[model samples]
Target: EEDQGLRFLQAGTALGTHKGMIKIPVWDCKKNQQASCDLSHRKNMEPVPENDTGQPEWDEESDYRACTYCKDNASEYLKHYRIASWFELIEKTENLASHMIQRAAAFSMQYNGGNLQLMCYPRFTATVDDLMSDLDELEGNLGFVPDLIILDYADILLESGNDERERLDRIWKKMAGMAGKRKVLVVTASQGTRKSLMSKSIKTDQVAEDIRKLAHIDLGIGLNQFVKEDERDERKAMIMRLSVMVKRHGETPSEECFVLQNLGLGQPAMDTYSFLRELADSWALLILTLIFLGVIGWAYRPGSRALHDDAADVPFRNEDPEQSRPEQSRPEQSRNDHARQDGACK
Candidate 1:
């Protein structure tokens, strides 16, 4: 809707009644002249009661002049009278836009956090290269990998049974592995066929149930609900698709909502499983390394010349001549004493 001031300016009229007295503001159409309110009736009105000797107090707020009766609706007149300029309007608009963008960014960061990585899977019309490029863009917005991702218009692949479906399945299967630490949500419209038949193109019930177990949200809207027969059925189909997409993927346009849930808690579960496996492997390696190092140290040990000799080798040291010199010297002394006694007897 157009602003009220803008509307009044365009129409060039302000309709107002004060206490049953009607006043019409007149604007000079000839020139952009300044407008002033005619206070003839205000002059007729009695003044406030005060002491005869006392002067009426002046107020800066009340001193401001009101708009003229004639040009009250005139844009130029209102601009001057209301003290609103075009530059001020432009400034307000810019500030409002900035505030809105900042608010959206803050809310997204608060809810999703930085740990969550968000990805988008557009329709099969997008190629692998296209997907990768889009992924880069998404990462730029998030500043990190997303813990959750959305497959937008996934039904497009279902339409084509060949390579497109294969590619999507492959990608999604890989994504599911990551889902232990992250999540992937797919959004699509439900087919209007009979639910009794197991062959409906869109299995809304089954997908919803499965996704719920996976902790992914699925929202399906039936196409038969909206009444837009005046336009092409494609229009109705598009709306159904869009509504389904928004409910499951979040944010109507892909550009608008780029954030995904962080799922940091999911990481701990993945870490626990990984850590146990790593710990087991590490324990095995540690035992093997200790045995190998012990054998090497035993083999490389200084055999006989070590500072601390082995107990088995200490016997050889005791058998050495230098180690038994005291016993050998005692035998020599007996021989010398025999020789001396024989010489003395002679």
Candidate 2:
């Protein structure tokens, strides 16, 4: 499946402890349906009278009836209906407001009281130049440049008549230029190529279209799922492999395995068993080669017959115990005393 850009955006925005503003430009909505609060249907509706219960009184004619009394009281019935609709609207508005407030409170509590302001552009679809113009306008209005700008999906911003590669390259260059000019981080996402779908791992080369896009990015991460054949018990947790495809400063061409805990949030997996299995698999050929070499060496090793005979007779060699022992002898002083005594006797 293709990458879900919106899910990633939501996950990324919620990650980390730093508090900052996140501006999201949604280009999918139509031009007329811009703001969340714009209620076009409310234009034809009239305000309802205060203290008016929605239910009709016993003496009042039902609005649905075709009697003369109903026709005469049509205005009153219409007023009543409007009041009922107004009441329903108020009830719905209250429920929505309450939900939003509770959600905000919960999010605030979860984030340790730090606030993250999320600003969304209404029905925004623009080219590179148009985006730059909007950025300039925003900076002018806010009196300062934003710290971060996230383009939801870069592939959708291609020009009308240009080649795909050329357009993408131009878009990336403009994005890089914006980052440099504003001194702000510009984050964007793109999908992998069709070939990457069947692959076990994703790399920078698997990125859609021209690989030159990697040159514009400081860091690029490729995410892929772990494929296994066991389908018996289907409750196994989902595991994903994340590869560091491109890194301008730090470690690159590295991999990390993780289990998805919630949404796009993943926790590092303890892969000791998997690591050992992979290690053994990777060394199998080398180990076999070494074993073959050892066998060849044992069969054809250059060795004299004399060397083998000497090694074989080492355990059987014996010597006389008496010949190996040293004999006891008298001291020189004792000998000298004896000689002196003999001389005296003479």
Candidate 3:
């Protein structure tokens, strides 16, 4: 299984707190084919072809039904997804949102859908055929045929001890094979060379093993973002601006696109919280009114009256004989001491 556990203690609590602070409400109508105000949850889940709109069709047969109904867990009907990981340096992205997040183009890694299966492969010894055999077993047993496959590190598939470039060449071809044979989209990652790390953007020439590795890819986008020392501290670096390095079809626009992200919340850039700004705008007056009322109530609460009265009298405490009685001897003692000092000086 792909371990969703975090490394540090209280990580989950900290992340939960962060998520609570960001109040991005996902309405059910937007997530379903039915626009419902009072929609109920569906019991059973089944696999279905998903459209790119990111909404869930709760009823597999209800595509014709109105999507205007607000779905409670509209996204709950997706196919059983399992996170399968192998003994490799890389990780796989199983969903379109995650795929785009890694590439820096999308948002939201919610937990309600898809079973992610993480399969561990032997280090630098397994072959693509061995991978196919395991996948075949997975399908035959679990009835889980993936539409997408992510190979954490292809270098582990074969001996990486010799012919680095040629090994990369073989590795990419094998990835292509997995895609074609399984009829699924295969995704993997490649790190940049040391020189490329220093550069603001990684170029095709900087691809570690072989630039030709991209030759087999349908679309390739280079990752880049603002990483000034100050910006890194502010986490503005999560605002990713990606450059399209290669595209199999269509013109590659020179213009770039950005996705503002906060992974601490386990969310990609969900509309960059632009929708949140709209929400605030729509409800600003009410929100402000409630806040004002709360402050007023806190200030005028029953106990606060006595507290404020005591504070108001603090400046005039010396005028009240009863209040000053406890300290009446201090000044006389100080004066007597000063007189004694004066006499001694004389």
Considering every candidate listed, which one attains the maximal lDDT? 3
- Model-by-model lDDT, in order? 0.34, 0.48, 0.51
Q: In candidate 2, which residue ranges exceed 4 Å CA deviation? A: 1-99, 105-124, 158-160, 228-236, 250-253, 264-346
Number of clashes recorded per candidate: 12, 0, 31
lDDT of 2 by residue, 1-346 (tens): 1134333333434332222332211111111121121333222222212123332211122222111221123333222111010101011122222343464456557643322333343332567777777778766765546677778766677455558888788778778888888788888887888777665567778889888788888878776653334311111223345666789996664445332332322123322112333444556788999999986666445652223443333322244334544654667668878998999999
lDDT of 1 by residue, 1-346 (tens): 2343333222221111112222211112111112222334121122222224432222233322322322333322332231110100001122223343464455456655665443434445654345446656766875665544554443343233455435445544434444443344433332333441332123345342123322232344323223332322221111111222224455532211111111211110111112223334546677889999986676456653222434444433435434555555777989989998999999
Q: Candidate 3 residues 201-271, lDDT tens each?
A: 66778888789888888888776553343222113324445677778899975655445554545555533
Better candidate number, 1 or 2, judged by lDDT: 2
Give the lDDT of residue 215 in candidate 3: 89
Q: Between the candidate structures 1 and 3, which one is better when assessed by TM-score?
A: 3
Query: Between prediction 2 and prediction 3, which has the larger lDDT?
Result: 3
TM-score of each: 0.22, 0.43, 0.45
In angstroms, give how far residue 223 of model 2 lies from its true place.
1.6
- Return the TM-score for candidate 3, rounded to 2 decimals: 0.45
Best by TM-score: 3
Q: How large an RMSD does model 2 have?
A: 27.2
